[model samples]
Target: MPPTRPHPRLRYQILREQSPSWKTMGTIAGVIFLTTTPLIRPRGLVGRFPNLHCPSSKFSHCRTTANTATDAPPFQVSAAASSPSSAIDEEKEVTSSGNVGADDLLIVGPGVLGRLVAQKWREEHPGCQIHGQTVTADHHEELNEEGINPCLKGTKTTHKFPYVIFCAPPSRTSDYSADVRMAALNWNGEGSFLFTSSSAPYDCNNNGSCDEDTSVVPIGRNPRTDVLLKAEEVVLEFGGVVLRLAALYTSFMKVDAASLSVAILKKRLRNQILLGCDNHPLSRQEVMDLVTKSGKFSETFEAFTGTNDPLGKRLNNSKTREEIGWEPKYPSFAHFLESL
Candidate 1:
């Protein structure tokens, strides 16, 4: 057998031909990594920054410390309705122990949408404890004025929150998922952790209609979407909820999607992705005309694309209404403005 053995060169060629190609090996390795690896990873830029421990007095009910850095979302949602469509993302809740208030809320990024949620929430639950987190203490006074206890982002509070709403956009941080994970870690699994996402992740084009089941652009397709999807994944992994809010208009109307999501959460629904958009999705021309008529904008209007560019996606929230018994206070943007 030894004498009949093939040459070393021949054996090498045979082995090489029989083995998998580099591409195949790479594909296998990637699959393994994605499947086994945890979505919550080591903190990126946050870990490098020093911690800014928040005082226990910041919120009389909840105690926590803060991390450095702030998140300012780069692009804004151009056309969003306060009215939101609804969807669901499913997962098991991650349980943890702490003296969390039964109706306590934590708003990570207490921006426009965040504060609105707080205001509406307070109106309903006057005694509920509400905490707001910002990158810096610059807004501490403003938040305090609104009756929300202010703290810094990445704050580790003594009492876990029943509801943790992440409203910060991805623009501010180098690592969006890490921020979400931090928020999730602060939750007590007794209530919902809601992440305000955008419709940019949806793959629909040419102003097509997007529903809860619409396919989202896969990761690696768009860097911006990757940030959001990663954050959403982190939320889902924590058995949290995600609300994909469409164009948000704060000028003449208020959106009820945030309150609707809370309604769903109170129903004890977990692991669902919901869409928040008005029942009537408007076009650019329509918006311009409306603003002009309402005297909200005096700038001269011009149409550059002339119907060439794709219209924005029409988000459908029928399921939200059917499932949660939700209806927008204003049926359409025009109706909302007209009411005033």
Candidate 2:
């Protein structure tokens, strides 16, 4: 009637098909895009996307910038974590504190080497206490004269020593391991325990080089070897050190030379002589010749043999030298003889 409005269906169809103005269309499109697409605001978005950067204008008024706020803390590294060798060096420094000191020594058997060690300790550390154990009563006065307190066998000691050196040879009747255990009972775990063992544990008959890490030759059924090995075990159990000495010789002990000369003398005099095959064999004429040439009642000769001897490998002391920084005063038999 008034403004004959087009039919309602026709009006709806015209509005749907008609294009809107540019500004109106742009506003409508922007509203739909914002709702559908994510609103990437710089404020909370920094935490979600840590690696991403925000525009300077977006956070210009913010107190903490995204780059400064999201920076990682500095890393801290430890000495042990950085180098394993440094850790080992520190451990060695700690363990090396067990080195021998004045007033800390106890010698089980104050024999030649024991006396030497005691003398050296006295010379180095004057007025320091050093105790020695001996089976012989006669050695008491001598040991006292040399400034060492002598302890008789089977004597009980109320004092605990920091260093114990066992120089006793393996006994014929007593258990060597028991002896070592008894001696080790004196240690308070504050210092080192050293045992003077023989290189016999390592047989050169096999013609192989041996070190501290080498496997010891089997003792088989030999009771003596078994006892020695047991003694070594007892020492090692106590965290002790074993010094496998070679054929020990000194200026005083002429056992090696005296025994040979005594054998020759008994044989030459037509006297009954008990000889072991371990002695160097010599013809009767050779013995006579030695006696005649020397013209002395007693003659001493070193057994110099060719390389044919299977037991010729020298005892290696590299472990002692490197570990304990020890060096022999007399390095060789000849040096010992020359010194004498």
Candidate 3:
């Protein structure tokens, strides 16, 4: 697992602004990553940390109320919000929400990863309505251009989607678990809900082997990891799936957008936890060697504080592969570079 921090938003902001060249390489590499997944049929897809919304059945004027977790913001709703005629129609729609043919997707966060999922989903299921949710309106225009109906986080609608994916980062909210629970409530349970969590919960600081069964760091030991674990619990309680992602990258790591494909491919997964990473893990020296040899990111090495840098845990997603039937196209960083 990578180092944990109190403020994940700050960390990601710095990473996003690191370099234009790096982002460009990541974008190109991401395309290659998605191509490896097996997409046999059209399934609902919801992505987050960058929510992408697709149209689904409207609410029945009576969304189920859920109890918020401790320290989470209260989730109160007015029961008499809709009129008689609308309520009856919505109730009728809700009754048949179980039908798979009309299922659509909601992506909580539509960042780079979410956008890629939306694009690919559209290619396979052109008639599907995709909706994106964001905290700000900054990217609404872009999302609209991509055929994703963008909406603000607090926006209320009559729609109840079959698939809801919470891909947003914790930095976006003070109480991550509360946000996750709210996203979970948006789903009708006719399909799957997935949360993209980090591998930081694993207690593998020694850079030892880490797998799905690896012991997790004791709760309350690290506030950052605590947030993730709590949020994951919320997802699980709601019968959603969790994907523990390792250091995600295009040029740096092989577990890029492939995880999204797996989510879409396996729609019935519930209360399951899967690890997402390549077969081979590299040390700082090895990573540097590869970059230097490729000459694609030679200048980026200055950002690393080599001698003081901590070792990242070696992640083996063998179980994830067996469980989800996923095999990464680029099984290792070496293979990813060779493709370039």
Candidate 4:
């Protein structure tokens, strides 16, 4: 007549289906058992549920003895233990290759940009050797004054540097590619070799943005562009880096008030002056007319000559900044001019 009780096995089945806390309690019990019995290996049990391995060394005793997930104890199961071996390998590689120290840099040309680079490098890395190479002996005294060791090309030297930066202009060298090859030969493939080039090789008429992956379409048979491309090819062949610079300006080249006045006076004698209108977004004729009508140039201009290259696109240095983590000290020519 009284209500009949459910079977014990049926009650357990109801509990298993209705509550998840029992499973959590089972896991906690397993962990407690594993922690208390250190001598008993849990490899067989751990091998059944491989996902339970510990994530890092901070948790559990698994950090000391666990090399594989199956060998780790129940208490040691975390996310760190389940990480792939490739991550460990990459860390080792970085540790071995990314060790650059003092006395590791050499600059091929110590001209305006080169000198600025040297000064900046010295500021970042004190007590480092910075050797500057110059073709002419005239710059020797000046280089020495700047605390840069002047080295002439083809001079015998036993010193091998880890980093080589070629700042030489293509116009100055007879064969720019040859110069780059010579610099690469000096490098034993230990560190990076960086060559400064120009963006003239790329014609950005179609696409305004030009990056490292941009295809180069030279406008015509330009010797300077050909030489720069050749040098870039040589650098790339040696797994080196090429930095294509936009127009460079420095405040140090600023003329004094007296010198500027003298220059303007001397310029009055010239019948015509060349103007680079490639940076402006107007037609040559329009720019010429604007220059002629302008009060300052009305007295001096008989005719204005403009560059053939059209201007609209800008050099996209996104790749350069992303790769080398370098940002321009002077973002624009106007900024550099204003600094003077």
After aligning candidate 3 to the native by TM-score, how far in Å is the CA of 333 from where it should be?
Answer: 1.2
For candidate 3, write residues 1-340 as lDDT tens digits: 3322111121111013123222221232221111121212112222111111111100011222332222333232111332221122122111122333444777888776676566656666667777787777788888877777887665554556666678788886766786787677767676667788888888775457878888788899999899998998888777677888776653333224444444533455666777787767665335435655765442443222112223457778787676666677567666665655
Any runs in candidate 2 off by more than 4 Å, and if so which?
A: 1-102, 250-312, 336-340
**lDDT (0-100) at residue 322 of candidate 4?**
36
Task: Enumerate clash totals for all models, in the order shown.
Answer: 23, 0, 27, 9
Candidate 4: residue 56 lDDT (0-100): 12
Cα error, candidate 4, residue 261 (Å): 35
TM-scores, all models, native as reference: 0.67, 0.52, 0.69, 0.52
Poorly placed runs, candidate 4 (over 4 Å): 1-102, 218-221, 250-304, 332-340
Ranking according to lDDT, highest score first = 3, 1, 2, 4
Better of 2 and 3 by lDDT: 3
Question: In model 4, what is the error at residue 41, expressed in angstroms?
Answer: 85
Q: What is candidate 1's lDDT per residue for 182-285, written digit by digit as tens?
A: 77767767666788887778888655777777889989999988889988888777777777876554211223655675675565445677777666765443
The TM-score that candidate 3 achieves is 0.69
lDDT of 2 by residue, 172-244 (tens): 2255676677676665545556666655565443334544545555767556667777887776666555555
Model 4: per-residue Cα lDDT at residue 122: 66
